[model samples]
Target: MSTTIEVEQATGPDLTHRLRDAIQNAEFAPHQRLIEADLSERFGASRASVRTALLNLAGEGLVERLPNRGARVRAITVGEAIEIVEVRLGLESLVARKAAENLTTKDAAVLRELRGRIESAANEGSLVEYSRVNQELDERIREIGAHATATQLLERLRAQSARHQFRLAFVPGRAATSAPEHVAIIDAILARDADAAEEATRRHLAGIIAMLRAMD
Candidate 1:
């Protein structure tokens, strides 16, 4: 009975989460239309549940509802992408500065370990693993910064950023190139150099913005 209940729930909101991840992971490319009937059959959900799930996804910014065409994956424009990077530049630099100011010796050691893991992930060419470690690193820095409001805001921004990363991960040389850039930011934070940490963070994000523009 418990198992049965869990399955029922999984076929509902859990299906929404699964779709959200698929969009974020680029399994569903931008502008790809989502057919309600298709999703219903694919996820073994009812048409009503799938429709509800589509609306939920739209609210999350993973999908957009068209006027008469129904829902499709949200396609990020170049200008919008730049705007996201611009905002991230400010937020990330602030986080880096705070992390530098508040970092403990133990926190520095852990960051160093995480950097090694990032390097390993990059070398192994595992974009998914690299993305996971990168998120862990970002969260750790936010925790070290100890700013509740800023961290909460950054988390919201990160959801949008994840999709950009998923798309960019396919760009040749992106992962390998970003690894050292990330290390520089970590090094500045670990060294307790607030200015350097902020500068490094700004440069890292700026590089991404430049690449995005070039791609466009």
Candidate 2:
């Protein structure tokens, strides 16, 4: 007998977002096939809705739709990973600079809290929690930057970079090193130093890029 995947009824966007998160967190490994019927049942959405979601994810490069094989999580190549980080270096530096200039007291508080959550998850070796908090921190920075266009662009870049980011985080000791980098970023933002914030963001992302390159 085939086992049934438990799925709760969810709206289109919600289901898409959930699947994206699952893919980013390594719940669905790289190149894992995403069958429409299975996902429709798993997300409790109609098959049509599932197809739409898959197409959306495909546009983001999080999933690849094969002509005959259907959709599968995208596997990032070394060259593609390097390109993603290079793009992030420029975009994230801009975000950090703007975040430093625009961060409110409330934003600072929330950022510090997120930094703590990231560090705690890292120390506890919870990759899922670490990835989740890390993405939240990125989004919060974009939010504080308040540039709608940049935020939208960064969101797309992030979706494409998810697989590479997962590989980096899953490496032993990578999370430990990244926790301090995030703290440096938060500290610069709190100090309201735009240059420092931008520089820190560049350094942090550059380090990750170097590590990835070394692995390749």
Candidate 3:
């Protein structure tokens, strides 16, 4: 579920962030019209603020502005999603390597706990839970890696491709297939094996690409 921003308290940037998250989380359907008046009322912001927020989202490629027709969520094609994941593959592999190199004892403990939760969610056939934990694992890896530039790039890429990912998570047996791959990533980091971590990251993302191709 997406976090709800309290009305009357959200600034322009806060509204933009909240709306971005809503779009990414599928709360707002792809291509759904975003009327300024509707959004202003919904977010309890002024029409001017809503317009500005929409403009910001448009720049991020998450919203499309129509001439005289206002705005709507952008719907990414499967091909586009695959391309985004391809870009992520390189950056994420680098992050995995750096994470393995920088893994401290405390990081290992946190990763282990996240790994356990991922496995449990997969085993229970809980797609929602699995997706949540999988994202947490990625965030933890990024934090451990400490790559600011890559992290910033990934944040946008992930948001852009989030809807496709949400669909993929519902594919039968996907969670089961991805669970071990995620575990391999965590295990390599725990062992401080940078090479293995990078390889594992590559393999995992490669699988996602394959699935995306099959989806196409």
Candidate 4:
């Protein structure tokens, strides 16, 4: 699926959400030019609204505007992907450690449920479910972490490298492997072991690096 999404009706808020969702879902391919007129008609919106949404994504580093080529999904080279994921490793390690300190029993329970759901989806080989779970877990963990700076940076890096994430998830067995890796991170958090949590998170990202390397 092209990660670019055109909604049925593009209200201002609806358009922004649709565009982000489409990008995150890999509805449009990386660097695929998003035709303004086509998108406007596809989402039953005015050309202005589609343009605005694209403009917003462009600001977020998820899309780029070219002089004549129009707006296209931001493409990540292998080096860029590695650099982004490296930054992510540091940010997420902070998240895991802080989340362990801050998460209440109820918060941990919620995370547990989410992980279970992720595992179920992975076992069933549902790529969409896995993708949703992956994002949800990251967001939920950040929420639990309760750190504004970390959350903001993590979201920024995530948006910047979303294309790579999409391709990685689409690989066979990758989604399934990601479930257990998530568990490892969550487990350390629930145990309130900050060093262990950080270490596990590092290992988790390292696993992704390994996966990417295997793909080469």
> CA lDDT of each candidate?
0.84, 0.85, 0.92, 0.82
Ranking by lDDT: 3, 2, 1, 4
- lDDT per residue, candidate 4, 84-176, as tens digits? 888899999998999999979899898889879888889899888888887898888899889899897787678777777777888887876
Q: After superposition, how far is residue 146 of candidate 2 from its true place, in Å?
A: 1.7
Q: What TM-score number comes out for model 4?
A: 0.82
Task: Name model 3 segments beyond 4 Å from true.
Answer: 1-10
What is the lDDT, from 0 to 100, of the residue 193 in candidate 1? 99
Worst 10 residues of 4 by lDDT: 1-10
lDDT of residue 60 for candidate 4: 77
Candidate No. with top TM-score: 3
Q: How would the candidate models be sorted by TM-score, starting from the highest?
A: 3, 2, 4, 1
For lDDT, candidate 2 versus 4, the one ahead is 2
Candidate 3 yields a Cα-based lDDT of: 0.92
Candidate 1: worst 10 consecutive residues by lDDT? 152-161
Model 3 per-residue lDDT tens digits across residues 45-157 = 87867988998889889999999888999999999999999999999999999999999999999999999999999999989999999989999999999999999889889
Q: List candidate 1 stretches off by more than 4 Å.
A: 1-20, 33-60, 67-70
lDDT score for residue 72 of model 1: 94
Output the number of the lDDT-best candidate: 3
lDDT of 1 at 4: 59
TM-score of each: 0.74, 0.86, 0.90, 0.82
Note the clash tally of each candidate. Answer: 0, 0, 0, 7
Q: TM-score winner between 1 and 4, please give it.
A: 4
Candidate 1 — number of clashing residue pairs?
Answer: 0
Per-residue lDDT of candidate 2, residues 9-29 (tens digit)? 346677788888888667887
Taking every candidate in turn, the Cα RMSD to the unseen true structure, in Å, is 4.2, 5.2, 4.5, 5.8
